[model samples]
Target: MKLFVFDLDFTIWNAGGTWCDSTHPPFAWKEGKLKDQENRWIYLYPEVKEILSELKAEGHMIAIASRTNAPTIAKQLLHMFEIDHFFDAREIYPGSKLTHFDRIMKELKVAKNDIVFFDDEYRNVEDIRSIGIESVLVTNGLTKDLVKPYLTRTIARDLPQSEAC
Candidate 1:
């Protein structure tokens, strides 16, 4: 089976320039702290969720490799947007995504050639490619219009049966 991995911050949603924007130690909320945390949500690009749903139907396993440290972000994603339920794994840290990717592939026993990764940063994409993994860069992040071609390619290559539909 193919493994699809994506970067969380800018690639998935615009968090105002950094992945830790919604958390403490960087920018703490002054009111309803816990509730505020619960209220916060990153807007998902329109096609992203639909494409992911389609990928799931094709037997592709999804995972996330990001630079987030707090586990609450994951919990919030599960409770608020239900995103956590979509991914088989959510790996987060401050360093390279390669670390997370390595772990996920290892744990899942997926080969590098069977995986594709997405990120907005060229550095991240290049690094991932260095490890012999295919990757795409989201120049405009995840706007619906901006990412259609990429979704098309993914659909064509991963789920060819859905290509005509």
Candidate 2:
């Protein structure tokens, strides 16, 4: 089985129009939205939940690879967003993307090619790709269509009846 990895900042949530490390502190769940002290709203991309749910339903392992300076804050945000439980593995420290994947590889015991990584940064995509992983660049935000093709193409053969993209 393939492990699906996503970057946190842009790939998972907008994080109040900035990185999670840059967001104001004392975040809370206010009226179905997550807002910080400055009232900047942090939210998941439209298709994030749907995409994650579909991947989980298809019996795929999901992971997070974030380069945020504040790993605690990032994990807090994930928990507050109620999506922390989705990630089977999390590497959320600011460091080489290579290291993140390396830890994940060791932890999950999956080969580099067994991972499908998504990130908004071109450098990250290239970095992960250099290690022979199947990486995709998430431009604006993650969408079902953007991820569907890659997800479907990779795992449909192993699935009983993989959903059409």
lDDT of 2 at 40: 92
Q: Write the per-residue lDDT of candidate 2 for residues 44-90, one digit (tens) a residue.
A: 99988888888888788899999999999898888887888888899
Model 2's TM-score against the true structure: 0.90
Model 1 Cα RMSD, 1 decimal: 5.4
Alpha-carbon shift of residue 105 in model 2 (angstroms): 0.6
Q: Tens digits of per-residue lDDT for model 1 on 25-76?
A: 3223345232234444345555677767766776778888886766566456
Off by more than 4 A, model 1: 16-18, 22-41, 69-71, 143-165
CA lDDT of each prediction against the hidden true structure: 0.68, 0.87
Top-scoring candidate (TM-score): 2
